[model samples]
Target: MAVLPLRICGDPVLHSPATEVSDFDDDLASLVQDMYETMAAAPGVGLAGPQVGVAKRLFVYDWTDDADVRHRGAAINPTLWIAPVPAGDADPETESEGCLSFPGERFPLRRSPRAILQAVDAAGESFEVRADGWLARIFQHEYDHLDGLLYVDRLTDGHARTAAKVERKRGWGVPGLTWLPGVDHLED
Candidate 1:
């Protein structure tokens, strides 16, 4: 498998929502393989198709602590279920985050602690998985990318500003605000 170049925050393709996969064939399998390779090479826990200029609803993630876990392969076309919204006056604490597309930048953002996901493997077999902790957050984050949502969009003013500060400290500039990919221009 070959590592694909990651698209940065400004790319219009990254803003667009991804198209659903109509056929789970050899090409899709190859793409998933490449995604896995690319994610591993980046040394990130997750990577999505849009990050590589592919507008397909696909992503690969490996949240295991051991590098040997890569031998288990990747998750394709995963479905995600986030925890219910917190009740009134409750604080949703922010968790540190990083993105494959935005290399060299890291920030804290709020996210649910748990999630359930289902997806088909490269062979078209379905599997369901439940995730919590960092794995859950990673799943939700990457799944959002498939829908053209970035972690920054979920941030409130204070968090966004804090994240921006961290980004600046790391010598990263403000990301270009643009329409979500695959969405209508009007919505953008």
Candidate 2:
């Protein structure tokens, strides 16, 4: 599978809601492979279809939990439901997150610490996963893309404005934002 160039923040494709994956055909399979490869190359734990310029409801993830167990899969036409916050940690913003679409930046955004995910596997078989902690966070982050929302949008008003400012300062808030190969990491 080839590693596709990522569509950065401000790309229209990223802002628009993706269409459902009605045809579980070979092309869809190939797109998923490309997404996985691209995400791996970017060294990101998760990636959505819109991030790679494909506005279809699909995402690939390779996440390792705190236990160090690795989980890898692709979700097509996925649906995710956030679980209620536990006592005392109602604010999830304390745990920051970063996105491949908004490479090199991160901001704390409130998110559910648990989630229920329902989606078809890469081969079109239906499945369900009960997730918590960082795994849950990844699902929510990717799910937002399917609905035309970014993690930055989930940020508090002040943080959102700051993120937008950074986007503009870096010449990112424009049409046709393309990937800049090696500079695509929050740690950078």
Candidate 3:
């Protein structure tokens, strides 16, 4: 498996909606394995297909909750059903989120505290997941990638302005942005 090149925020593939996975074959299985390896190399809790320039509706996640239990999962053609964050479920303050696509930047964004996701596995088997707390936030973040959205895009006006300023300083928001797994500079 290879740790594929990550597409940056301005990459067209990152902005375009992904195509659904129709064939659950050896090729698809290989892509999933590669995605898992890439996510691990990124050291990110979650990653989506478009982040790796695959333009497919898939994502892989391996995250630990506050209780120290590890939860690992992969979703293909996922449909997320998010639940409203109740008055008591979480602290009212915004939560911080980072992405492999954005690399060294982390931003605070509002997300539901719970969600129910229905998706299929690499073998085309169906499954449902109900996640809450930080895990739910991870799911929502990755789900947004399938629709060409970054967590920063969900920020409020003030937060978005701050994020945009940082993005400009970082030399982002250009066409054809690409980077190696560990390299900060854009690739040719």
Candidate 4:
């Protein structure tokens, strides 16, 4: 396994919609392994292929609290469906989130207290998962990467302002000012 370099927020590849994996072969397996290594090295809960400069619908995540334990797995060609029932505050409180792509920035993100997702694994096996709290939020956040969306995009103005303030406090440049490679001029 190898640790791949994470593409920063200004990398254009992050904006490109990832292509679906057509074959589950050795290459895909290797990619998943590499992604796991990269995520572990970054010490992040979740990672997507686009963040590593790969335009494939792939992501790996493990939300367990034990940092010493390496429990990581890949999701390929994943799809999400919001739960029918409204989430209640009894589940868990919102937590501040930081992204690998957006260094030195953090923002509060509201996520479903619980969620159910259907996805395939690296072996082409189908699985249904029900997760709550931090794990659920991690799954949803990584899944959005496959769709060419970032967590910041879902933030409201207040959240965005908070993120910018966090970056400034950390002595980093203003968040969202950098032009991600493929997305630079498209917003004009």
Candidate 5:
């Protein structure tokens, strides 16, 4: 497995909806493996296919919950269901999240505390997960990537304005920009 180059926010692939995986073949397996490697290299809990320019409906996650239970797997052609997010402003300290595409930046955004993820493995076997807390947040974040939406797109108030300004200042939201995990030094 290799650490794939991650597409930055400006990349069209990151902004476009990903296609569903129809062939559960060796290529898909390799992509999933590489995604995991890239995610680890990015030091992120989750990474999506579009983040790597694959434009496939898949994401790999490796996050250990507070209970010390390790949750690790690839969700290919996944369907996610989230409980209604709580009403009111987000708690900046607890609700903030970052994306591999956005890189190094974290913003406060509201997300459902619980989520149900149903997807197949590389081998085409189906599985389901009922997740809560940070795990739920991870699922939601990655799922958004499949639908061509970034966490920043879901931000509100000052956070939303700040994200737009950052994108403009950095000259992102275009196409063909990417960063190699562990190779480039990025400051938040």
Candidate 6:
């Protein structure tokens, strides 16, 4: 598998909702494998199809929780359910998150503590996962990509303003922007 070029923010694919994955074919499997490789190369916990310029509903994640249990898999045509976020401003120390699409930025954003994810694997076999803590947050964050939302899009007012400035300062709020995982060397 190869590391795909990651689409940056303001790319149409990253901002638009992705289509469902109706064909469970070899090409889809290859894409999933590439996504996993790209995520690993980016050193990110998760990566979505849109981030790689593929408008398909899928995401791959590899994260080890506080309990030391490793969670690794691809969610194809996934559906996610989340509990309501706690009532308070986001805590930067605890709720900060980064995205491969945005690259080298982390900001506090409120997310539900619990989530239930249902999806099929690359082979089209269905499965379910009950998640909490960071795993839950990962699911929610990736799922948002399928719906055309980024973590920055969900940020509070102050953070949103900051994100806008960063986007403008970096010259990233336009289409045709992309980065290679290993070559770009962006760290969060």
Each prediction's total of clashing residue pairs, residues at least 3 apart in sequence or on different chains, is: 7, 0, 0, 4, 0, 0
- Model 2 alpha-carbon miss at residue 23, Å: 1.7
| Model 3 worst lDDT run, 10 consecutive residues | 85-94
- TM-score, predicted candidate 2 vs. hidden true structure: 0.90
Positional deviation of 149 in candidate 5, in angstroms? 0.3
Once model 4 is optimally superposed onto the true structure by TM-score, how far is the C-alpha of residue 85 displaced, in angstroms?
A: 9.7
lDDT of 4 by residue, 113-161 (tens): 6777777999999887777667777888888888877777667777777
Clashes counted in candidate 5 amount to 0
| Residue 33 shift from truth in candidate 5, angstroms | 0.6
Q: Which 10 consecutive residues of model 2 have the lowest summed lDDT? A: 85-94
Model 6 misplaced regions, further than 4 Å: none
Residue-by-residue lDDT tens digits, candidate 6, 2-94? 999999999999899999999999999999999999999888999999999999999999999778889999999999989988998999999
TM agreement with the true structure for every prediction = 0.77, 0.90, 0.90, 0.77, 0.98, 0.97
State the lDDT of candidate 1 residue by residue for 87-161, as single tens digits. 433244547787766555465666778898888777878888787677778888899899888776677777778
Candidates ranked, most accurate by TM-score first: 5, 6, 2, 3, 4, 1
Candidate 3 residues lying further than 4 Å off, grouped into runs, are 85-94, 183-188
CA deviation > 4 Å runs, candidate 1: 65-73, 85-94, 162-188
lDDT of 5 at 54: 92
Model 2: lDDT equals 0.84
Candidate 1 matches the true fold with a TM-score of: 0.77
Cα-based lDDT for every prediction: 0.71, 0.84, 0.84, 0.72, 0.92, 0.92
The alpha-carbon deviation from the true structure for residue 123 of candidate 2, after best TM-score superposition, in angstroms, is: 1.3
Error (Å) of candidate 3 at residue 141 is 0.3
